[model samples]
Target chain A: MLEVSNLSVNYRGIRALDNISLTLSPRELVGLIGPNGAGKSTLIKAILGLVSFQGKVQFRGKPLRRQRQRVAYVPQRSQIDWDYPVTAWNVVMMALTPSIGWLREPDHRVKQAVSAALDRVDMLPLRHRQIGQLSGGQQQRVFLARALAQQADLFLMDEPFTGIDQKTEAIMLEVFADLKRKGKTLLVCSHEWGQALSRYDRLLLINRQLLANDRPQVVMTMENLHRAYGQSLQTTMGGNAMGFSFC
Target chain B: MLSPLLSPLAYEFIRNALIAGILVGILCPVVGTYLIVQRMTLLGNVIAHAVLPGLAIAHFLTIDILWGAFVSGLLSSFATNWIRAQTRIKVDAAMALTLASFFALGVILITRLESRLDLDAFLFGDILSVTVKDVWQTALITGVILLLVKLFYKELLFYTFDPLGAQAMGLPIQVINVGLMAAITLTIILGMKTVGVILVTSLIVGPAITAYLLVKELHQMMALGGLIGALSSVIGLYLSYFLDLPSGPAIALTVFGFFLLGLLLRPVCNLNRENSVGKKLGKKYRSQKSEVSQELEPDA
Candidate 1:
């Protein structure tokens, strides 16, 4: 459902990603694994078209803007400031903003969509609670509910399991399994290989470029694992002739 | 509306001053709400101080100080944006650069204007000499600014709360940011009359921040900030009347006092909530997790 080719990103004359190419098939559950500053987020942001990048990112064989309606992004929890008084409903309702779907006062369909999404993630009980009042796991699930409410065909989730309890992790895996069964595609970036490799059908190991993109059983070989997390590799965000892509 | 608060001499001045204070109060919170959320309260201080030279230069040139304040305030706001966009220097550093350089120039200009013109009245607002024309100016400028905020609140909230989401949604994030900067500039400019340039930012920031720490919701914060800001202005003015004190400083201090009281009140509530929620969730999560972890550990 998503294809990226020769992507490069430069921040202040330093290359964060260098000629990275990856792809996900329809309804595929793909895991992206990397160390800190491995261009995992850069790839996600570049795909979202939030920043400038080079190369190509196509979803459903169209540019990002044309196919943006079909894509959903669940950012890492640390990136948000939860102190701002917002409820789960507010967060989930963003799935339908500024469209024919925009509801000044939520209608039946909007409420149904939000509630169903929350129910899918096992968080219907927390629907009325302020997002700040939720636990870490539930907060991540809340964003997933929002993504699900968008009814998007593709989900790009970055580090959804960080600081979450085992129940949340189990819930996340169940959602992924369900998404796969329902013909929806997902690209999840994670650091926990033992759990992720066991769950996802494929894994894409990224460090500036496509280190390996294949079945997790094959790509996550001992050699690849050592190279990915071995002996403290120098990971500079802006480095050599590696970046400068726009898609 | 007739009130016992003013004599004929006192009425005209108080009327003008009250209009100015109320206008400043209303406009300050409109922008101050955003600033408080963005942690840009110090940025307001920088802009307030930076406009002094603008007012001083106008005084020296025998022109209107309001235009001078507007031009300088906008310049500072522009500079704040430029500095943030250009370099890795933190926002505070950029603010310090603008504040020191601009205010020092204002100090020199005011000294020069002092010899050639009556500048002390503008320095510390001689609000008691306010004319009907001044009241009209306050009403017109503040009215336009507040109208802009009312019209653009949704767009502003989108960017202020979710910049990444707004950009993804294809909103002009830069334009909205610039619009907010403009609102903040107009607020600081008009606020200078009631509180003077030196303490204008304190008036802008004090009550808004107090509400920020005390309130959890965005709409509540805005409402509380406006109510507190207007209250402080009226009460401070009254205290200055009875105590025979400097009105601007007295009001600023009162706002600061309210902020301190609100700050002290916060921890008590937070600590109580934290204790109860932690105890409740801790037991439930632990029992649930142990049961699940056992189920997962079977293959080993």
Candidate 2:
């Protein structure tokens, strides 16, 4: 569903990501795992055309720009301004704006789509809550809801499991599985590889470049893990309202 | 036993000042919120100061001030864009350069106009000198801006909150940005006669910031922003009347006063048990920030 070639991103003199090549087929569930500063997000941003990069990215056999409508991106919950005065519903509504009018009110169809999307994520309960009031997992769910509203064929999520409750994570996995069943492809970036291995069908270990890409059992060997995240796994606890535990 | 004691003549000026301040107040904060969020205060300052030369030239020609302000504001707007496009110079630096050069040019023009023009009227603002023509101009610009804001509300919201998302949506993000900037440029020029260049930003920042504290929704915040703007305007005009001070400063300080109220009231509101949503949001924000850097640099 997506192809990236020679992708390199340099922030000033520091190279965040070196030349990297990877591809995903239709209906594929791909997992990206790496250490901090491993260019996991840099790859995502480069593919989304949000960053300046030397490489090229193609989606659905079309150029990235042309296929943007078919792709839905769920950035890390931390990247969003939760304080933005928008309801869960408003955020969902926003994802559909590309399909509808900017200023025009949503038609019944759009509303129905948002409703179904929210329902898929089990977030229809908190549809009216101020987004800022949501927990990290809930915030991620909202983005999932938004993507669902996008009704896109391809899903790109960054750190979807970070800070989320185990229940929420399972629910998200189910949603992704359901999406895959519907012939929708997903590429999820995650720090927790143990959990991702079970959730994703294929795994790609990345650290500045593609270290490995294959079945989880073959690609997630200790050698590849050391090459990607190193032997001493780094743990950073985010102080979020959810009080997520790392150890 | 109180009496409603306002003479028609005094009342007219009071109404005019109040209404004028109210309009500027809403527009400033509504626009200022985006500016502050995006760290574009310097841009507003630049545009505000940059238009002085235009106003000065207008004075020289002895035509309407808004006309001169508009021309100069547009020139400075283009200048800002040109500098942004050409150099590695960041936005603040470009604003500093263009605003400084243009404002310096304005200073020279003001110096020239001093020989043939009214000083206090432009610098401190002569509220009493406000004619029906000035009112008409203010009203016209207010209508233009509010209309523009209404038309572009969705796109502006998208751009302000998420520039990347807006770009992905195939929206003419650049054109929208330029359009918003143009509206701000017009707002500053129109407000110059009432608030003067030095103090116009407060009107913009105060109402919105104040409302930001009071509400959690965008629509509510904007409405409250306008309400605060209007409230401050009336209060400022009334204070100006009794104190016999300049209208713009009075109105500007009034907006500041409202900001103080917001500061004092925020904690009180947050402390309210019934406002659990506010308290919850406050706690959540604290928690999220705490998790920002888990894999820290050991040396650092």
Candidate 2: where is the Cα deviation over 4 Å?
A: A10-16, A222-247, B1-5, B8-16, B56-102, B108-123, B263-300
Give lDDT tens digits, candidate 1, residues A3-98.
Answer: 888889987788989998777887788888887888898888888888788999988788776667678888877777777656677677777664
DockQ of 2: 0.20
lDDT of 1 by residue, B33-140 (tens): 888777788878877778777877887777897788778877887787689767888888888898888888888887866835444554565666668898888789
- For each candidate, the DockQ is 0.21, 0.20
Q: Which candidate leads in TM-score?
A: 1
Instruction: Give the C-alpha miss distance for residue A95 in model 1, angstroms.
Output: 3.6
Clashing pairs in 2: A1-A24, A238-B291, A239-B287, A239-B291, B28-B204, B29-B204
The alpha-carbon RMSD over the true interface for every model, in angstroms, is 7.0, 7.6
Q: Residue A135 deviation, candidate 2, in Å? A: 1.7
Q: What is the Cα-based lDDT of residue B70 in candidate 2?
A: 77
| lDDT string, candidate 2, A1-247, tens digits | 6888998998767799889998888778999888788889888888888878998898766788776878888877667787887788888887877778756767999999999988788666556667776677777788888888898888888888888766567779889878898998899998764534655678888888899998777775657766776655444322331222210
Q: In model 1, which regions exceed 4 Å deviation? A: A66-69, A100-112, A122-124, A233-247, B1-10, B53-68, B105-123, B264-300
